[model samples]
Target: MSKNEKYSHESYLEYQGKYKGIWGWLFSTDHKRIGLLYLYSIAFFFVVAAILGLLIRIELIAPGPTIMDAQTYNGLFTVHGIIMIFIVVIPGLGAVFGNFFLPIMIGAKDVAFPRLNLLSWYIFILGAILAVASQFAGGGAPDTGWTFYVPYSSTSSTNVIFALTAAFILGFSSILTGINFIVTIHRLRAPGMGWFKMPLFPWSLYATAWIQVLATPIVGITLLMVIAERVLQIGFFDPALGGDPLLFQHLFWIYSHPAVYIMILPAMGVVTEIFPTFSQKPVFGYGAIVISSIAIAAVGYFVWGHHMFTTGISYWSRWFFSFLTFIVAIPSAIKVFNWISTMYGGSIDLKTPLLYAISFIFLFMIGGFTGLTLGALATNVHLHDTSFVVAHFHYIIFGGMGFAFFAGIHYWYPKMYGRMYNIKLANIAWGVLFTGFNVLYFPLFIIGIQGMPRRYFDYLEQFHTGHFISTIGAIILIIGIFMMLFNLIYYRHRGAVAPSNPWKGVTLEWQIESPPTHENFEEIPEIKTPPYLFKKES
Candidate 1:
């Protein structure tokens, strides 16, 4: 096929194909377009979930009901957790950025299963629709929380079945995406690009994909069992019938725990890419970083029992899980040290992306330290169901993974859209988000230690002040988020045209045109040097 002249002069945003307008994007098999599909869809759900989170905060701002009743508050938070965990964070980086750049980084035209790539997205959307639809169509919205724990989940009159079904479908979508990535990485690396020569982002995705493939089915089957128990009354989780509730926790966390790595690994991959580019050095300990990614995925599976310590498990099991949890942190700390070492003597750019990456380290450290507290037997007994657990989780997921995602978006914004956002505004947004995030969740940590329980619609008078402060922080954080989103949207159309290699990134994707062509390269480029080589531009 002859290359169109427009492929050189125009971005993918302007390139026309067999179908015109919406239909073109909706049905197109291009990995980049499919990635954007995930981006836009995920962004929509993120906003919805964010709003729900804000409402939850507002309701907790005062001791008494501020916006909704107890039942409504419970339902809202349940939906919020479901949407955020399943729809946003778990698939956040891999589905969006990974799908967009993995093939290009590896010098392939697209993912090995291009059609299946599109199918995975469709399934994700369908699952999201079912989850939301349950709120309006069923007996009521689910009140079992995102975990959908037993007895309560089994007995809830609300839409537990619909929520379970939604989770099940989403798991299928995740598994397909994982399979596509694994096959693409194994089969499609450019000539001479050996296993060690591949970029860190793809390596992280490789590790995450394996976890997704191996671990997600456990949750899929577990959720299916929940649905069966609810419908068929088979009594798997309900003690009144014949099954053990603790068994449900065991099965659930088996997948859910590894699912944590699925959410954070790609985010770490994003940070890995950004550090070397902005710092203008090869990532410190490249082999260590790669091994750490694989190690985290492997060790993550064995630590699920830490989440179940509050339940009555064998004494040895609790200590065993706690030990495994601490062991997982060693590799995590190694990655952190390597990142810091990479920036030690380098000419750092201090761009918005790096700012977010730095912030991720700080926030993730706090989350990690607090996680150790929970991993201990005595501390887990005190903090397991308190707002402390909630605070630590947000610090890791929102503060860690969420910051890394923002870093990826800013670092790749120019490449993805062929334009640059206002740098000053981007930095300002980052500052606000960073400060507001700490203020919001830090107060929760204080109150949680003061004995505030989680998931309570109302709080004790002693905790009211902390709740009030957190609510204000939530508003500020939302403002910063909106500002950042607005800046990106506004600049996509009007911002200055970007250079192909805006970040001076050495990855294969940076060698191609910005917003790369439908067929990424005219001919697959031969790889010679390692991926992280930082050459001084003449």
Candidate 2:
């Protein structure tokens, strides 16, 4: 516990148990431990989902239902999408980074409601287990896709009811975490840390929290209605019972669409933090970036129709959603521009975090531009369910959000663990990931454009070349991910001794001892400027 002594990982757990026990890990309210728990759980889900991804990619290598039957393929993509979106991305926002760093970043003792934060995590785990258990209960996981669109969902042979119910449970966890973060940020700022003075990372969390609180409930009720139709046969979305299937699309996208923003906004926030610090300059458009984040969250709600453009939505609604979709990209573009501007004529440090951040901008740009093409109703008719859409999204989510998550992880790994990862290995891992990710995802773009649909185990011979190339990419990509994990996990104890500020960035976390203490700070420090305002010591 002393500042000079190395923090024992076992010691932290021992202190936690002496004070609380199994109940401590289960019922305690330490944000760092909670964050660590999230870190562990989400990474577990990520691996499972990633394996499913590899399976899907492998099946398509030669085409024609190589692995599982069509029905099983349906289940694979369904569970893959469900676990990745609801279990992995949603909980990750508040549970992992927010839990561990939000208080540390803003100089608070804990979140405004620590117990509620703990409760949120349990609810999330419970919901994840319930969703997984559905695979065994009735029909072995729902095949109605992650969205669980109505008529198919209502009449599907799979355990649609159980799956929808689990999703509803996760929604509550998302809402509570969002609410906890909002209240904490609003009420818990340290002295002299005005709103503008707070770090961009917390500001991004603040924006993301609003999206969670306001948008998540819609999905909660929407899923409940889906369950109602399946169980009680109330028929809100069942056309046979005086309901409209398209209405299901509307209500579903109402939540599902903004849900994507919830995943990416906090990521954008993390990138915002990294760009300035590594560039060693003030954020080029601080006020503009903050406003755009809020704008993206606000405007993100109206564009759900874009996802349903191929579902026979009215032309006017399609046009409106298209316009809104294009408008949404403006804010995101501003962020990218601002990041590049921050690097303009500045001291840009080519460290691991900076490498990931720059990669995020590149991948995000491709995703955003391609999304515009899909948003256009005319172009979307061809690409609606194709690999183009798949490629665009992976680039955005995997390349954009996943990379940002790694960037944050690498940027803070030393501070989080009180140890340094092998810099050579770290760079090598990043190189592998960056190379393999593009190899894995980029060819799907070509395959999709040549008329290959996503989730199809059978494809025409014309797409074979692209599919073959994509498989090679997947192998390399997995290697990259494994290397990154090995260094973080196996190298934790044996890595070089990390100083308090290995990156030499100006954040409150760097001001404290590595791995932090039981309370995060012995004495919470006061900040007079943004966390990334790099100033050389005199």
Candidate 3:
């Protein structure tokens, strides 16, 4: 038995019976339960956000505020983006998967700071509650974009301050989780596990955690300034208060650009895991992929200026920002190349996880390539703030992050729940989603090329056709999402019983029993080789 398990009480072994009902779930702090708490909570928010997304798409189908007024539509997209990014996607991967699997993957008893990990979950819950409360609080919803760009955002009629405050609190939770992971990795590896011997997903979390610790605080402080400007009327971002709005952009993007890294690094980790297991080989160039993750995280922060090129920032600064933006793409492209190369000659298995990984590669490629176009100062002058920007970000955020999040969930579901979902149904869901995704975003490229600004509830005659096609695609996309969620969650109790290593994956997590016991391992397993070194004999 593990050392911690030896000391743990009999009550610890009875995790399932700790509380008789929902209250048990609300208060439980076992990492697995906390992970499931995140799973259900984040998934709930995702459904809410999807409804808002569908609403936005529906209104755009025929254009000119078909279902609601302009202000209502503005509130819809704002809340949708805010809730999805802050409440769902930000916490979805790292907190949900990392909290549950990181310790188990590395052969540890618990996170270095277990109670603090619990506290972080509570803080996240509080932040999520505050975000939801903004809808019913003073103003209907914050009309400010997720970025919360200032001066205009500061002076908006909506409850911008409350929403920004909620976001800041969430950033605290994210930073703490990152710190816990970094310390745990430093102190808690199993007997023979070296840096290279660690699994790629946790390594990705390690890199992502550093970005969280370092970059999240910048945005936190920036949001604080926004709240101060609103409440105390301090003019840090206000020209009338003798502050430059441009400075706000500078500070915001410092965190916000790296914040994109916060969003995608975990997803990269997901793809990294899927490619190796499904390919049935050691990950090709594991060291290169690791270096590329760090490179992307480090370089990600310098590229935020590309978002400011057309905002009247200096031309010299614009050129510098543009250069860095293009430079950041190199590391990301390297990751994609490595993933494809890993699958090149291996025995490919097209399971649900592999399907998501394949989609991630395609969608992220489109998102990345389009980003290059927007990064060039000359090209951005034409595309800035258009539907093009909308399409580009969704491709990265929704397409890239969304697909990878699914990959992780499907990849880890058997281990976490001790059940296997219906494979044919899961693949059908993926097929629908794949078609729906391209149909939905591809037309935005058309409307953007023809000039339709985003965040406008109303638009011109020229943009309607493409908008309609995109809206129909959005409906298809939502259907696919619902089917996917149902299969994953509903099938848990009804699904087939799973084996520990159903997919023949080589990771340490697969070596343990499904729905792992209170004590994660039978014993602390030694790692004599690096992760993903598949053995043919087994």
> Which candidate achieves the best lDDT against the true structure?
1
Better of 1 and 2 by lDDT: 1
Worst 10-residue lDDT window for candidate 1 reads 1-10
**TM-scores of the models, in the order given:** 0.98, 0.96, 0.96
Best by TM-score: 1
**Over the stretch 2-67, how does candidate 2's per-residue lDDT look in tens digits?**
234565444234455445666667666888878888889899989888888888788878868787
Worst 10-residue lDDT window, candidate 3: 1-10
**lDDT winner, 1 or 3:** 1
Candidate 1: Cα lDDT at 390: 92
> Which regions in candidate 1 have their CA more than 4 angstroms from the true location?
1-8, 536-538
RMSD value for candidate 3: 3.9
Superposed by TM-score, candidate 3 places the C-alpha of residue 524 at a distance from the truth, in angstroms, of 1.3
Residue-level lDDT of model 3, residues 1-538, one tens digit each, is 2212221222222456557577666766666777777888889989998999999998988856699988888788888988999998877899999988899889887788877888888899888888878766897788887888889888998988778988999999999999999998999989999998888889899999999999889989999998999889998998988888999999998988887888899999988989989989889888988898899988887888888887798878998889988888988988998999999999999999999999999999999999999998888999999999999999999899899999889999988877788889999999999899989999998799789898888888888899999998998999899889889977776787677788888988888877788768768888898888788734
Whole-model Cα lDDT of every candidate shown, in order: 0.92, 0.84, 0.87
Candidate 2 vs 3: which has more lDDT: 3
Tell me which residue pairs clash in candidate 2: none
- The reply for model 3, stretches above 4 Å from the true place, is 1-24
